[model samples]
Target: MATQTANALRFLSMDTVQAANSGHPGAPMGMADIADVLWREFLRHNPKNPKFANRDRF
Candidate 1:
């Protein structure tokens, strides 16, 4: 699951940058695994009410 998310993020970054003909996509591509893990496991959110005053969004 994590590997797939990482690969997907990398592919999206590369594709978007390539299409735009600008920006450095390589770093994001390389860091996707770490980013995915953090976001998927450690990052907190309240999707039902994202703007809730007490939501631990950070």
Candidate 2:
């Protein structure tokens, strides 16, 4: 599942670069797994209200 997630992320980056005709894919492709894990485990958000004006989004 993790492998699939990373592959999907890489694929998305590839598609994005192709569409935009700019940006480098190496970083996004190589760091997908790390980024995925970080985002999944550490990222915080409120889909109901993204701008709560209290939580530091940084």
Give the best candidate by lDDT: 1
Candidate 2 is scored at a TM of: 0.69
Question: Per-residue CA lDDT of candidate 2, range 1-58, in tens?
Answer: 7789989999999999999999999999999999778656676766798887664353
Q: What is the C-alpha RMSD of each candidate to the true structure, in Å?
A: 2.0, 2.5
Least well predicted 10-residue stretch by lDDT in candidate 2: 49-58
Q: Please name the candidate that would achieve the greatest TM-score relative to the true structure.
A: 1
Look at candidate 1 and give me any clashing residue pairs. none
Q: Give the C-alpha miss distance for residue 28 in model 1, angstroms.
A: 0.4
Q: After superposition on all CA atoms, how large is the RMSD of candidate 2?
A: 2.5
Could you estimate the TM-score for every candidate?
A: 0.77, 0.69
lDDT to native, each model: 0.86, 0.85
Q: Write the per-residue lDDT of candidate 1 for residues 17-47, one digit (tens) a residue.
A: 9999999997999899989988878877668
Residue 10's C-alpha lDDT in candidate 2? 99
With candidate 1 superimposed using the best TM-score fit, by how many Å does residue 32's alpha carbon deviate from the native? 0.1
Which 10-residue span in candidate 1 carries the lowest summed lDDT?
A: 49-58
